[model samples]
Target: MKGLTIQQMAIGDSATFTKTVSESDVYQFAGITGDFNPAHINEEYAKDTVFKTRIAHGMLSAGFISTVLGTRLPGPGTIYLRQELKFLAPVRIGDTITAKAEITGLVLEKNRVTLRTTCTNQEGVLVVDGEALMSPPKA
Candidate 1:
């Protein structure tokens, strides 16, 4: 991946990426992030939650935004400034998540870009929605 300094992005650019959440992914993320909440691992325990089954962590779904911004839309060296997220629905194992982002604004002086972001599952259910701020490297 090449460096992306704040000159490669435009106000109307966009990107999309997808990934499937597996039991292994949840487990690994739990181990790495130390978020071993039962709802993310124990099926029986998860049944008691509002979701009725084990669900992926909200942050995990949001992580896809980083993947999209850093690797696709702006590509490498993109710096994340801020993000505002809402967990709309549960993400379960076997669910294919498609994350989409559309550039909404470009702060030329600040060298920042704002994006409207959303993540939906294969069932067309939105799992996450948010706004992200990033500084893409100059072209």
Candidate 2:
């Protein structure tokens, strides 16, 4: 429960979670969400595309950010309100992605926190960038 409450969070407080993208990750996500787009599942189709290989679903990497917000930064019982994401680059299998969130604003009166969210790959290239609005459980 490392996630902080609104009263406890500072403007610069931050947290992160990381995972190496695997073939299974992509497939499982596709299975769970039923998003079997050729770009993500068909090797032959992907080979002809711009990426030249299968890419993990963008939302799968975004889920890592949710993990950080729910379990690490604002811990459990945090309610996600809104998220804005920009998929900057493709995440291929075996790419280690690190998702991070920093508290940039806190509205104590409303028990809301504004976080700057981002995900970066093993090569140090940013794959995603976004902002999230959340409500941490009232302590």
Candidate 3:
């Protein structure tokens, strides 16, 4: 579970994590975060929205990006600093998503890594895209 420190990581280093979005997953995330947005938690309310159906929370998918940083690319002991994300398409229940993170830049002095982040659904549709800045573990 040792994470790659700044020096141990290369510009092309990358990792991915995947999961199927489910009704229970959505409800659990909603309860855990207290988001309770009807578009996420209520079908009747969601039907009136532009999405026309309940959708998983954008942050739910974003959290999957963290899975890559914390457990795969950087492994354990990584310190998350910042992230900028864009939600491109709706993530519906039963969609399988793969969250990917690739090292794009490194700052030796700062022990920081900049990664291009993305999530694609089972249909290969881009659901979320972003950039993350993180402090890799110290050696």
Per-residue alpha-carbon lDDT of candidate 2 for residues 91-122, written as tens digits (9 for 90 to 100):
99999999999999999999999999999999
lDDT of 3: 0.95
What is the alpha-carbon RMSD of candidate 2 to the true structure?
Answer: 1.0
Sliding window of 10 residues with minimal summed lDDT for model 3:
1-10
Off by over 4 Å in 2: none
lDDT tens digits, residue span 5-110, model 3:
8888889889999999999999999999999999998999999999899999999999999999999988799989999999999999999999999999999998
Order of the predicted models by TM-score, top scorer first: 2, 3, 1
- The worst-scoring run of ten residues by lDDT in candidate 1 lies at 1-10
Candidate 1 vs candidate 2, lDDT winner: 2
Error of 3 at 105 (Å): 0.3
Per-residue lDDT tens digits for candidate 1, residues 23-86, read 9999999999999999999999999989899999999999998899888877787888899999
Clashes of each: 8, 3, 0
Residue 78 in candidate 2, Cα distance off native in Å: 0.2
Query: Considering lDDT, where higher is better, how would the candidates rank from best to worst?
Result: 3, 2, 1
- The estimated TM-scores of all candidates read 0.93, 0.97, 0.96
Q: Given candidate 2, what's the lDDT at residue 2?
A: 39
Q: If candidate 3 were superposed on the true structure by all CA atoms, what would the RMSD be? A: 0.9
**Model 1 lDDT on a 0 to 1 scale:** 0.88
